[model samples]
Target: MLRPIRALAAAAAALALVCACNSASGGSLPGKPGDAAATRGVSAGSIKVGGIVSMTSASGYSKKDTDLGARARYLRANAEGGINGRTIDYIGAEDDGQDPGKNLAAARKLVQQDKVFAVAPMSSVTFSGADFLEQEKVPTFGWGTLPSFCGPQYIYGFNGCLVPSPGGTLNQTWPEGIGQVLGGAKGKSVAIIANDSDAGKFGIRTFRQGFAGAGFEVAYAKASVPATAVPSDWSAYVKDILASDGGEAPDAVVSVMQTPNNIGLFTALKRAGYRGLLSDPTDYDPALLAKDTTRQALDGVHVLLQFEPFESANPRMDQFKADIKAASGGREVPLNMHMLTGYMSADLFVSIALKAGKDLTVAHFQNAARSFSDTGTLVGDRAEPKGQKESFGCGALVRLKDGAYEVSVPFKCYEPVPFK
Candidate 1:
């Protein structure tokens, strides 16, 4: 049965979503709220869950879904009975922002210092600290779709949606989609521009392989710049696009760069007056189109799909959305895939943790996670005509419509695109 969703204002909702997860569990567990050795209780005890997010970077401020949203949803979980009587204690979080090394340090601090039972919401740094998590037996989980990191005992990732994310279990969806685009487009040209970072390299290589398999010839592909690299004039970048190496000019340019650079690359494309279809993953926010005076510049540009949009037929998603909106003070809470990923991450983590039972050690949490599926989550319910397994339940491809995404197919799920 659906719980009563009390409507509140955005301020109230923010507060509600950010309540202290580690308070005196079931009366008093002692020490500053998040002491990992929280007292065991009959009905309630604090289950410390650590978080790492990009709080200090551009993505942190601009993206609605960040580590804060993950923590916020866990707070919401705590209000919902503390996950089988274990109140979540989001003891603390560190700001990795966009740095991979920082992510590793934060994860270490959370596990070694905070004594958290589990990590959630795709801490992003898990890839950096995968060894520590597996060695320590700390279960690291997330709504991330990247699959390469989803291995050993230390890592567990949620596909989040049928569509692939920049870094999640389904990161390979771009390559698969490119296959479809190229296989059908006859001899259409394709190009790629991703940073030189671990994720950037992975995204570029994976798609390059997939596109090649699908018989699409690459016109030109280059590592644009790393995330840490400061922005530059980018005139050379534009020249590179027009000069398609040895291959023919592409029918489209696929950029694997993050948002700020994405804007830059597109701006340069327009300045060069080159008219070709541009492609990007779903990482780019539709809202950015609002502020960009270069709106006319992106006409007919395409983006990859991670999952069908939430507005698609999904009773569970619709209800949770309403509940979230009500919790956010009656105003339509910003219900994008990012926030939904946070919610889904929170929900799945809770399910697996409690399913591990009161004897809950990190090992049990890990075991519970491997056996779990999206059978009861909002994403599962929202998916219609389910057919795919590794895919986020079942949903069709999506395209940016009216600056927002809309589903192009209802449940035409292909296999999980291989990013590994």
Candidate 2:
């Protein structure tokens, strides 16, 4: 009885499809290869693309301008006759709010409903949709700070993977640049702090090895800070960090967190009379200088950057500035690293898609990706598949002083140290 009922249902569905096809004057069915090709986000004149970004979050961190950066790159590409004469139909971006569930939902909406051919500028603290995007064979590009970017065939990081598992090499820019700032790693002590999240824990693990490998004494490393809420009181954290060197403050304190958390902690440290060197990966934005308190708190602080700073004299950097200004309607907005993140992500996608030739398809894109290599890019020399497991090993350090930024360490590539 069950088998008969199932067969009847299947027959009914087939009949409905045939009737629909007949209604369309004997047109082909939707699941055919020709239909699939036509239905994809590509056409003879354009390629549809979209983006996912953590534009807003509970902690007040926003990557909203990443959309603008991507738009700037896309606009430039389109102005220059597009990729193989097909203008990119960039659909802007989806705000994920940094929520994992929302991230997945946004990705699904883009693929299932929007039918975008690819995703670029996927700037988010969480990438819960990585697995779904991979299974669906959707090409994704973003800043590769999470483990999800590693070993995924369909996902790419614009600057290569920042986080890698054992047997992979770690970018030594952070530790090595810090070592250079302090004159030497020998006889120096450091404390590393991060939020109590997967990213944070992994950051602690990676940097612990990096600093130790650079000959710095890893006096303290902890990921006990809150991931979502910014703690108002930093006394307890300060106490632990101050005594991390067995009774005295470490020579340097490093934070692997965003600006809000950094401001609170660094302000607290100053209040607690910690005069040692301070550093973090974020907080290089010039807009922070608008407030006196923010400037004072970050005064003399060194920041780790994985690309050439906005102050670079490189011709490409000048072009980036011009493109951004044009994208913003001639309004000069204060630049941040997030902009570069988006620009580079889109730039990488465009570069590969162009190489895939005029008749673009997912298959062609992946084939091109396998051999993608470019030097003198804004981030660094890029190559595919290898980037899934390793970094491009390029970065620099900048220091803030009296409301200005100057390169403490020049932008350059360094050999990576193996992750133990």
Candidate 3:
């Protein structure tokens, strides 16, 4: 659900740009090998930055708060004295509307017109701007759910890359955490479903191996659901799923899809009288609780969380809540994963910028990122180059009971299984 697309056409079209894009060649920013003074967005007193978020979308799935999240984090950083005495001049994020063309256009506008030093919290399923950002040597930070976050020197995931190439390690968090909830993964069976898109296919491949490695029988794994539209009738999917485990339903049903899809699928499964563990990565939002149908549909469902849950006592979580409240004009607001998405994305950028030292250039940022590592933060110990290849191997699971969310599993780092 971290990277949801409307259809295969969108992903295929966006990925098509990868071939035409240039790849970074070294630790320093490309183009001007040694000239830090000529960096695009760095001024003597400020470092200008921007973001690209799916603030609006055709399907009505908006991550609009992501912009506010980035703003809050940046505002906090500036208030705390900014990086190396240069306050971050955040011009805010552009709305991609979850379209490939618009995503690319927004990236171009940010770099070419606004000349942002970096693009943090670039949240959207259609990231056609990845190639352009890398080619331009822009240091971008975002959720590493997509393949673009992996193997890219100029791009980073706030929590490290979720999808990595062969020989790279896989995050065992999802499987291991789920295992903990079900007593153990020893003989549990799971049926995983996703959209029939590039990201969906990749998710199935990565997660299938992860679950199997965790000792679960992947009873049914497929990226067959149509991505363009949510099916009003999920009977076909439910029918196959109920019998996926040798004529009986699996012990758990995992949906690697967004809110709309999860709601439909989970509702169908429940109506079909299949009482089993239902899990997904995207339904942790507090906003969904307002609607009775959504609340009932997702009741008893466990959602994946790459970061510490809000219910956590982690001091960093408290700081995030405070920052979020301040960003929302001192008004308490409903929290969602999208807000964390932007906050953490900006946090990583700020962390690396601080390590970049007082010089504050693209080259300095890249140099700092090459050896960056921090511990006990929200996402666990973050290490780069390594993060560029694998996840931090940390996470937790939260379940919706009645109308509130409770941490089903404690936040902790787990040993990652090697991805074959």
Instruction: Estimate the TM-score of every prediction.
Output: 0.74, 0.91, 0.93
Kindly list the per-residue Cα lDDT of model 2 for residues 252-316, writing each as its tens digit. Answer: 99999988899999999999999999999999899899999999999989999999999899899
Point to the candidate with the largest TM-score.
3
lDDT values for all models = 0.54, 0.85, 0.86
Give a tens-digit lDDT track for model 3, residues 33-124: 55555678887788889999988765567888888889999999999999889999999999988777788789888888887889998998
Model 3 stretches astray by more than 4 angstroms: 1-14, 18-35
Candidate 1 regions off by >4 Å? 1-44, 58-64, 123-127, 143-148, 160-172, 175-185, 245-248, 282-286, 294-299, 326-330, 376-398, 401-404, 408-412, 416-420
Candidate 1 or 3, higher lDDT? Answer: 3
Best candidate, lDDT-wise? Answer: 3
The predicted structure with the larger TM-score, 1 or 2, is 2
* TM-score winner, 2 or 3: 3
**What TM-score number comes out for model 3?**
0.93
- Estimate the overall C-alpha local distance difference test score of candidate 1: 0.54
Q: How many Å off is the CA of 103 in candidate 3? A: 1.5
